[model samples]
Target: MKIAQICPRYFPDIGGVETHVKEISERLVKAGHDVEVITTDPTGKLNRRETINGVKVIRFRSFAPGNAYYFAPQIYFYLKMHSFDVIHAHSYHALPALFAALGKSERRLVFTPHYHRSGHTAFRNLLHKPYRLFGKVIFSRADSVICVSEYEKRLVEADFRVAGKTVKIPNGINLAEFKHLRALQKDEGIEGKTGKEKTLLYVGRLEEYKGVQYIIQSMPELQEFRLKVVGKGPYEAELRSMAKSLGVEGRVEWLKDLSRRELLKCYAGADIFLMLSSHEAYGITVAEALAAGTPCVVAKGSALEEFVDGTRCLGVDEPIKKEEIIKLINKLKDMKQNSRFTTESLTIFDWDYITEEIENIYNN
Candidate 1:
């Protein structure tokens, strides 16, 4: 089977959707299916066309100046000219995905909307209205609509009124990799932090909507733990200022652009993983944390709440109070110390299982 994955961005641009496309596309290629990715060169630096890990990637010039929502007209033309067994579009908020939906293709159109009803800021929220109007038409075009979480599926059904042919297929992790790391992992504490101070890890783009500010705000009350922030984004400067203003700058360490191995080690070593996003389609890092046998505390109303079974994971509502976060952290730490912490079974998130499900969608 020949498959075309249409997304706004691809490799080297790290995010949940990018990682999802890369993992499934590579696995599909390994399974003897021909796979190609069509995305935009947001940075204008990546090769226009290249084959990586047996999967072909084609990036077109795009007009994505600041915000990640790219505008690529060529993708529509490319879709009209090419033929494939499946045309899988990702991220309803991105224009390239919308264009892929609009393009005339006889192939079965499988769409993973990655939908979030609103955005982080008022401006982005305003922009969502137009995107939603566009997405209604895109949803109509999909032969099968793939949602990453139950929350996303509900939003798609409620907002777009998508009835049948909508499937809930959550994002997956490389279970083998995490298992290997767990096997060989040593108790190497955080790279620089001394003593056995509890380690709190936040790994993802440091965007404002990600709710990193809430964590930083709570640091004044959480002086016992060291916060290690991984990943870079536009919101770094503001977060830094907030940390300094709160006089907790010394407790927070900002690490950016870590390699995959280093990141897994961080997940393995951290005492607790924090994903306090205001809006998340699915918290892939939370799954990664669980796979590493690390406990997680996610935002209450986000899609992550569905995955947290309250054993190794906990959820707190948005605008989370400092005292509440501190209490949860303390509870998780006690649970860890008592050896009573057990992560949710993450076999559902294994890439092998996830890819098989995606293959079935394409075949059907």
Candidate 2:
């Protein structure tokens, strides 16, 4: 079967949706299905056509103001001309999926809405009131609507009143990539912290909604731990200033351009993982931290609250005080030290299983 994965962006861009489509598309290719990714390039710097790991990728030039909305009308024309057995569109936040839904092609339109409900910013949030009308086309036309988390499913159901088929399929993590890091196997418990400083990690886009700023606000009190931030975005400057104003600049390491191996190591080595974002359809980084047996402190109102099972994870609300975060960090350290951690439970989300489930969906 020939499958088309439509998304906002693809490989080298490095975000949740980008990585999701890449993982599934490549695996579908390896499974002997011809898979192609139709995405947009706002900067017009990437190639228009290329093949990575046997999965074909076609990028169209788009107009993305403030790196939001990713308007690409060319995608509609392309899908209207071409045909595929299955056309899976992703990211409800971007416009390409809706464009794919609007195509006249009779292909099975499968949509994976990594939906965060509202927009990422104040301006974008205001646009959502009108955008909700356009979103109806994608939800109503889809043969099957796939949501990445229960939180997303609720939002999609409530806002769109979708009458068609819907299913919850969470994002998967590559546990094998973290196997050698020994985040689970190592016996280095409380003893490991005896002579060294704990590394607090924040690995995602530097957005204000991501709550990285809140972490910076609390940095002045977390003197025994240094921060390693592993992504770049518009909010980096603000976070840097916050760190400097609080005199924690030297302790906060801003990291970007890390290879997959380096990132896995960071997940495995960190004492605690922080993702205090205001919203998340599914926390892929939180899952990765869990796969690495790292303790996580995520925000409560979003899908991330699902990770808090009183084991290796904890939750806190927004508008938290610096003292609260410091307390949470100390609690997570003790929680991890007292319990036995393992990656065995992470097997349910293996890419092979998830790809097979999607294959079954297409086959049916």
Candidate 3:
């Protein structure tokens, strides 16, 4: 089967959606299917073609930050000239999904709108009415719509009124690298420390909506623990200030643009993973943390909660309380006395199973 994945962004520019597309595309290719990705250029070149991880990747021009809003017309143009067994259009920005639907290609159309949009984005909010209209058109045109979580499926069903056709396919993780990465990094003593400390890890964009500030607020209350924040975004300075104001500035570590190996170490070495995102279509970091045998605190009512049960994840209903965080730290410190942290096999959500579900979708 030939699959053409249309996404607004791809790696070297990282995010949950990019990671999902990359993982699924690679797994499909490994399964003897052809996969091609259409995405926006990260180099700002807007060039048309390249290959990454054995998949053909095509990039076109886009306006940074807001360019994701206009990917539909570009995808429509690209699809007119090429062909695939399925065109999987991703994102909830309305543009790409609209074009993929409007293009009306003979092949199957599957829309996986990762739906990570906040109720912000002035243009998107202002044009909500027309956005709904366009969304209905695109959604109705698709053979099936895929959601990464039941939360997302419900949102799509509620908003788009496409309840019957939507399906859930949870995102998967690659655990091999994460398992070995900490030992490698510890040997090298990266982050200016020898081995894993009592650490709290945060990975993903440093954006306001991600609610990273909640973790920052919890830091002053956590005296012995170090907070390691990974990924790049616009909210760095504000977060730094919040850390300083809370008097935990010295313990806060800012890591930016880590390679895949380094990323695995950050995940593996951490005593706990934290994501305070108020709104998440799906949180892959929670899965990665689980795969690494690092327990996590995923906030309640978000999609991340679905991937995590109480045994491996602590679900907080609001910005994590200082007392709660400190208590968790103490619990982890106590658990460290044992050789292992927490044991719950997450092999079920591994890429192998996830790809099988996706293959089933394609076959159906």
Candidate 4:
């Protein structure tokens, strides 16, 4: 089968959608399928056409200033010219996905909206109303629509009335990678840290909707823990300012663009992982944390709630209060020594399992 994956951005961009496309595409290639990715070179620096891990990646020159909602007219022309067995489009809100939907393709189209009705700010939320009308048309064109979570599936059905075609298939984690890391940690006799000054980790884009600010606000109270933020984004300066204002600057460390091995080390060393995002279609990082044997504190009512069991995770209300966060941290501290933090039940999110499910979807 020849599969064309349409997305706004690809490899080295460091986003959930980008990671999803890379993982599934590489696995599809390994399974003897001809896979090609159609994306935009947001920086205009990456090779326009290249093959990575047996999958061909074609990046169009984008006119947009930043990576968000990239505008690439060439994508439409390419889609019209190319032929494939499957046209798998990601991120419903992205322009490339819209072009793929609008393109005249005879292939079976699969859409993974990665849909969130609103953005981190008020203006984006207001725009979502009109976007819903456009979104309906996109989903309506697809042979099948994939949602990463039950929460997301409900939103698609209720907001866009596309439930009949929508199916739940979650974002996955590289379980073998983390298992190897755990083995290395044990062999090296490297336990995270022994006493006080627990390592608290937050890995993802530094964005307003990600709720990194609330974690910074709660830092002054968490004297025994040191916060290490991984990943870079526009909101870093603002978060740094908040930490400074709160007088917790010394206790917080900002890390950006760590290699996969370094990231797994961070997850392995973490006493607790924090994912307090205001919204999440599916928290892939949460799964990664679980696979790394790190306990997580995620937002209540978000898609992450589905991934947590009481033994390994604690869910707090959105706009997380400092009091509750502190309370949860104390609970985690008390249990850290005894908690197993195993990934035994997270096999469902293994990339191999997820890829097989998607293959079945494509074959269907």
The collision pairs in model 1 are none
For model 1, state the Cα shift of residue 107 in Å.
1.8
- Give the range where candidate 4 is weakest over 10 consecutive residues by summed lDDT: 339-348
User: Which wins on lDDT, candidate 1 or candidate 4?
Assistant: 1
Candidate 2 per-residue C-alpha lDDT over 1-364 given as tens digits, one digit per residue, 9 for 90 to 100: 9888999989989888988898898899989999999999998899999999999999999888887888999999998888788889998888998899998367898989888888899999999889988888898888888888788888888888873577888888876776666644354332223338888999999888899988888888887898989999999998999899889999999999899877876787788899999879988999998877788888899899888876578788767666778888988777656765433465228777788888888887
Candidate 2: where are CA atoms >4 Å away? 183-195, 337-348
Relative to the true structure, how large is the alpha-carbon lDDT of every model?
A: 0.85, 0.84, 0.76, 0.84
Write candidate 3's Cα lDDT for 287-362 as tens digits.
Answer: 8877776788777777877755656677777655656756765665566566445675663377778879878888
Model 3 residue 310 distance off true place after TM-score fit, in angstroms: 2.6
Report the C-alpha lDDT of model 1 over 28-76, residue by residue, as the tens digit.
Answer: 9999999999999867789999999999999998887456679998999
Q: Least lDDT summed over 10 consecutive residues: which range in candidate 1?
A: 186-195
Q: What local lDDT does model 4 show for residue 248?
A: 91
For model 4, residues 268-318, the per-residue Cα lDDT tens digits are 888889999978899888888888878889888768788767768888986
Per-model TM-score, in order, reads: 0.95, 0.94, 0.88, 0.95
The number of the candidate with the highest lDDT is 1
**Sorted on TM-score, highest at the top, how do the candidates line up?**
1, 4, 2, 3
TM-score, cand. 3 vs. native: 0.88
Error of 3 at 326 (Å): 3.9
Candidate 4: where is the Cα deviation over 4 Å? 63-66, 187-191, 338-344
How much is 286 displaced in model 2, in angstroms?
Answer: 0.6
* Off by more than 4 A, model 3: 64-72, 116-130, 178-197, 319-324, 331-341
